[model samples]
Target: MVGERKQEKDVKREKVRGAQDKGRKTERKGQKSKRTECADFTDKPRIFPAEVIAGKPVDISCTFDTTCNGTAPVLTWDTPTDVSGSISNTVTQHGVTLTYTSVLTLTASLKHHGQTLTCRVRYPSVSSERTLILTVQYAPQDLSMTSLDMINASLINIIEGNSTVIICSVKSFPASNLTWRHLNVPMNRTSSNNELWLVIPHVTSRDTGDYECVAENEHGAVEGSITITVEHAPRNLSMTSLDMINASWINIIEGNSTVIICSVESFPVSNLTWRHLNVTMNRTRSNNELWLVIPHVTSRDTGDYECVAENEHGAVEGSITITVELIICCVESFPASNLTWRHLNVSMNRTCSSNELWLVIPHVTSRDTGDYVCVAENEHGAVEGSITIIVEHTPQNLSMTSIDMINASWINIIEGNPTVIICSVKSFPVSNLMWQHLNVPMNRTSSNNELWLVIPHVTSRDTGDYECVAENEHGAVEGSITITVEHAPRNLSMTFLDMINSSSVNIIEGNSAVIICSVASFPASNLTWRHLNVTMNRTSSNNELWLVIPHVTSSDTGDYECAAENDHGAVEWSITITVECRDSSEWTAGLLTAGIMLNLFVAGILTFVYVRKSKTATEERVAEISDIELSPSPLTVKHQGKQNMLLTDPRNTTREGETSAPQGSL
Candidate 1:
């Protein structure tokens, strides 16, 4: 009994030995997916034959393959609870494949059959894993079955044209027969130690449905089922218009209703969602399809958008990207390519037919006139065409003023000083600019939006209202500004006693003289009369300065100046007034004529030569004269006027009570 126990211990030690203790074996080739005709192999881990009898020590090995290189791999094994195991790793190289194997040696029991043994290997480049369902073989009591969940095929998902492996293993010993059927039909299968592997190298929709495994012994028979549901990842993800036209990108107009419909096809419907950048959306949805609608699209809605659809089994992504544009359109391109419209090199919203593009300007104002360009392009290159549209409308915002003046309706320009009159206007189709003086057209140079009327030297002729006229084919507008030209006093002269200019005045003693001054200037020059260069009273309306010297005498002989002035400048004219004395010979001649007139004196001289005295109050008018009587002694004459009275010898002047001139020697 001691030797038998020792033999059992040796067997258990043998089961726990490394995989290299036996021999190196070539690694099995992995399966590959087909793109065209070439299939690429996949590097993954594998474990097999998941059944063992009770009280039996078994050596379980999991193998993984990778491209043969100098770098080695590391392996680990995870076993069921309370099932201690001896784990070891071995590496074998055969041609281009390097196989890494991990072995788990343990005693089998019914309590651990339903558990799992997982083998994990990490290479210098990658990592892989494989799980084995450890089913313990029980003696046939009533031929009851145990579960092999590694092949628990309620529903299996296999991509079309791809390969998959199905496992059918038994937990009972001494099986008489083992077979696999697809709808009760026999199929090619691989078997080892009451275990089978059904490999469908290429799957199709017809390969779907139940595939059953039957295990029969002398006592009873047992059966298990695997349901294969072949499917493919989502394909042909796209966006289409209402007419079902496929599109990669879409352009929509601003402030208009628009929609983007995304669709995809797969064996199973996928969950669809809309996205912009990285954020997911809770948008309009209908079973793997969605519509993004903008009832009143605005400028902020222009951007890039995406529609994504995905599913389980093998998750796949189908994406459709959309772009929104502003008010612009373009059409009439061949080779079926994308088109774009730009205003000053900017994209805008537009309407299209057969992708017909146009730039729409609804309720166009004067500001909407400019040049636009449209581009038709593909992957090769791009060609661009341009259009210039002018929106004809009435001239607007018309205003007129001088450059030196700020929004003033009137400006004062000094005479002989330079100034400018400018008018501002806005219109389409190049508005015609014009300037006018007092409703009469004046020649001017102007651009479409502004006009200038230059007055190099301002004069009275440029003092009227200047009108600025801006007109287009649609309508006309006008603005007016008054130019008040200021000038110095000019053309100063006198008009009294036919004295058109400044000159001396000869007046006998006791006689009156008159002088007047006038001038012409803007702002109605103020005229003043000055005595001996001294300023007199000033008046605006009265441009006339009267120089009336009543009862002129020698003392009054001086320069009397007349001045005209305004805010611009002033001018003056002077008159030299002189008073002369009468000769005595004239008095002797008058005495001899008085003797002849003595006979007529009784009829007319008595009435003319009476003693009379009078005073005058009118300052600008001449004083009236009174008759004087002849006297034996020299007599003096007195007169009343605005000036002081002067006295002279009686022989040289007329005296009261004198019928004739005083008799005096010359």
Candidate 2:
């Protein structure tokens, strides 16, 4: 029994001794790896994306790709400022596939204005720690600009094709995108470092408007705007009338006036003026007529007349010539001789030979009584005789006694006969008794007492003026008388016709009326109408008169007057008419289509109202939630165990403009 007890104690002692040997071997292995492993850890503790955002949140962390131990090491974050707080391990393991998140807020601090933050990780067995430093900085801010305040361009300015530039210099912390906009059009953008520019090609009126620029940063935003304007001048200039000339012989009897006009076509309109030999006559638009009234003139007021037109661009001038002559005569005794008569200051031999000739004066006016003389010359020296005399004209009396002296009568002949009119007058010298028809003379007699006119198959062509003139070695005189060659009107008819449709009758609108002034008459009489309360426009047809309304309205229904007049006399006719209006509802089986259109229009309005209501409801819900989030209070807390205590914040994890809180917080 003693030997068995001693054997059990020895077995126990050997077990205890084996356990101690294993522990020593593990200790030696751990110590052996310290130096060699540290040399193998070549991954230089990197921190990715080191830029700091001012007034915003950022993540702070590093990579640890070395050491494969089961225990997690301690990670310490130390900034250049005391604003940094403790961090926790977001993910935990020992070596492979292990991650950690920061518990402290990575916000900008005063001490870390231009400095950096470093994270150091250490294992319990290692004597030194691995470190990574991240740059702690803020984004750009505070932008400045410089340029001209207002740029004024000239009147007729042009920006040659794509070469117009408006440049503005800017000073900013960071480079920004520059944009330009006009109130007339959409915005255009460009990018530069410290300056922004807006360029335009061929600037037109549409390019003139308000322009703007904007600069922004993580802290805040700022902007500026300006206005641009463009201008233009004028266009399209021209002139008026081309020519104006006075009569060759100014024969103003007495108490008469002459008026002339000149004009120009311009954008702003122009003025007219008449300049006559240093005499300026000003005229305006309303009083543009230049009137020259001569009252009972004897012999004066003769000069060159000129018309000048002026405007903003320049001036132009035109002229005409004029002359005036005198007409006067004085009475003398019966034995006194007449004034000298010069035949255009040239001499001519007498065709009729009557020796011992004496000059005789016949019935004459003041114009023909100027001068008279007679010269007789044989093969010897010439003998001259002169007469300075005054003459007066007497009105011819058409009494019975005068009618016998001057025979005058009318007679009818055959269609192709030669008609002759004779007027034998008894006076000191022969007097002219002219026979005229319609103020125009036929080829009958010229300065002779006999008239012979011939017509070949006479018709209406044989109508109009017929005259017989008589003058002998004195002043000439004329007398005219009209003759009516009656016959049927050429191209005559009595057919009822339509002017508009050429049919017997035409359909018209109830609100409109047509004046059918149709007349089928002889002698081609003129058409005339005198209608009150209705407008008139005479549209002459080949054989009809289209008396049209100025316009067609509901009140165009009344009696109309129609007249046909000729040289013989005038005749009147009358007619009453009614008007009708066009009906817009005269659709042929189209009422169903109109009904469908009205139904669709109502349905569209209902759909629009329903969509508007739905959008309003959604906006109300969003507004209520936004009010709750704006209040600074912690409603929901994310509990990420111990690591989340320093890293998690409600404001940091919320979306922009969204309400992030628990239901109770609202």
Candidate 3:
């Protein structure tokens, strides 16, 4: 037993040794794997995007390959100044390998642009680091304006007609776009990187306002403004002569005091002055007003005058001219001179001299007409006045004239139209005129020896002889004209076979019918006949139209019309021709027979219905009586202690005080 036990121990010891060797081999493989595991950055820093927008959050991740060694990995990030960021790490396992992702979150700023961000990963056995260059995209900032020639100020003032340039600038990453604006409206400008130029070749009041410099980028926009003021000299200058009667021209009478005023419109107050004949005149100034006064004007003062208004910027001038008139004397004449007048080498008749030389003419007559001269000699000069007289006579001949009426003695006019009659007379002097119609005075208008008689809306009552009479103190004459009023045909009448009062005519079939249309009018009108609005055979005589229908038939049964037309209008008279049928008697007889038959049929039906109803009622009464039982006691009853009787037959019932039929007999 001792030998068997020792052998068992040796066998167990050998098995133990084999187990230990296997355990050692497994541990060695694991150690070798742990030693070979290394963390390496898989994503290169150059792969990251180069640009990022300021104030926007960005996420960047660095990936690494490593092995799991029972310890957590550490991730660290180094960020640029003014850039805030957070780092996180994620580990993913594939078999025995681990992928480490380190994510860095950052809010970028302009200060962070062109800076480096580093991400480092530390593992139990290995470590990795990555560096990335960041380019931060930012909007424009620090917008400002600089004046090229003028003073640099938020509010600037410039002289009118002067050139100026303004530069707009901004500071930004990625180069900002710049523009210029005037009073919130965009201005045309020349632009470059981060700057815009606004060039004004000539500055005027229109350019005075707030000017803005606007800078913009994909991120945002900013603006700054400056005020501009423009100063200008006086403009639209005007000069006025206060003593002149006309505003367009200066004309002052001799010995009259005159004043010239200067006016101007300008941004700044201006000084005003007056000059005459290119020489400065003595003037007075009050505020913007300057006046030059001449106490007594003369011919020497009749010259060009200029008013000048000037300011620091520039000056403007306005000019005017003055004129003077000399007075002259007048000559008079009486008893109407027989001589012609002469003034300034011109011969004047009495009428012309009366106006030109202020010469008086009294009792002017042709026999006293001649050249008359009145001479006045003075030391300075000699002047003469002469005149010739003429006389006017009264009317002599009178005549009538008209355009529409060929003959002045007579005229024909349509109703509701105007008529003009002119009575002309040959006379030197104008005459009083009047119109006489039907021996009664009428109102008329007179001009120069002519009498005008105008009649508007002429009617039948206005037709008469019109006499025009023209008279002056010396003579009188008269003329006459006749006016006739024409109107449309009226009071149209239709006659049948000389029956004048008839309006409509009826003719028998196969007989001739003559229809006459007569109308009342001053002048005979053209007449025609129409059947159903179509022209038919007609004969016209005077104001009458005759429509004759020969052998009238049923086909001719329709309305016929007679029409009459004159210069004024037209009139129509209508009549109905109802042709009598040839079979009238037969038609009447047939109608009577039909009516009789229809009445008889209706009567027979009514009689049969009445008889049937009577029979039915009789049978019903009999049946009802049969249903009643008869009493043997005479069918009697007592009422109010008097004998009252009941009849077996209902028709036999008795009224009060009436005898009843015997019951047995009923």
**Segments in model 3 whose C-alpha atoms lie over 4 Å from true places:** 1-51, 55-57, 62-65, 76-89, 94-97, 102-134, 151-164, 179-192, 197-216, 219-249, 252-269, 274-306, 313-319, 324-567, 571-666
Residue-wise C-alpha lDDT for candidate 3, range 405-469, written one tens digit per residue? 73436677888888888777654346777888887888755456776778777887886667677
- Residues 96-197 of candidate 2 have per-residue lDDT tens digits of 334543444576643355454555666656523333333333333443333343444211223223235565444333455555555635466655444567
Which candidate would rank higher by lDDT, 1 or 2?
1
The number of residue pairs in model 3 that clash at the backbone is 13
Q: Pick the candidate with the highest lDDT.
A: 3
Measured on C-alpha atoms, candidate 2 has an lDDT of 0.41
lDDT of candidate 1 at residue 319, scale 0 to 100: 45
lDDT of 3: 0.61
For model 3 the local lDDT of residue 30 reads 59
TM-score of each: 0.30, 0.24, 0.39
Please report, as a residue range, the 10-residue window in candidate 2 with the lowest summed lDDT.
Answer: 640-649
Best-fitting candidate, scored by TM-score: 3
Q: How many backbone clashes does candidate 2 have?
A: 28
lDDT of 1 by residue, 553-572 (tens): 78887777778888878898
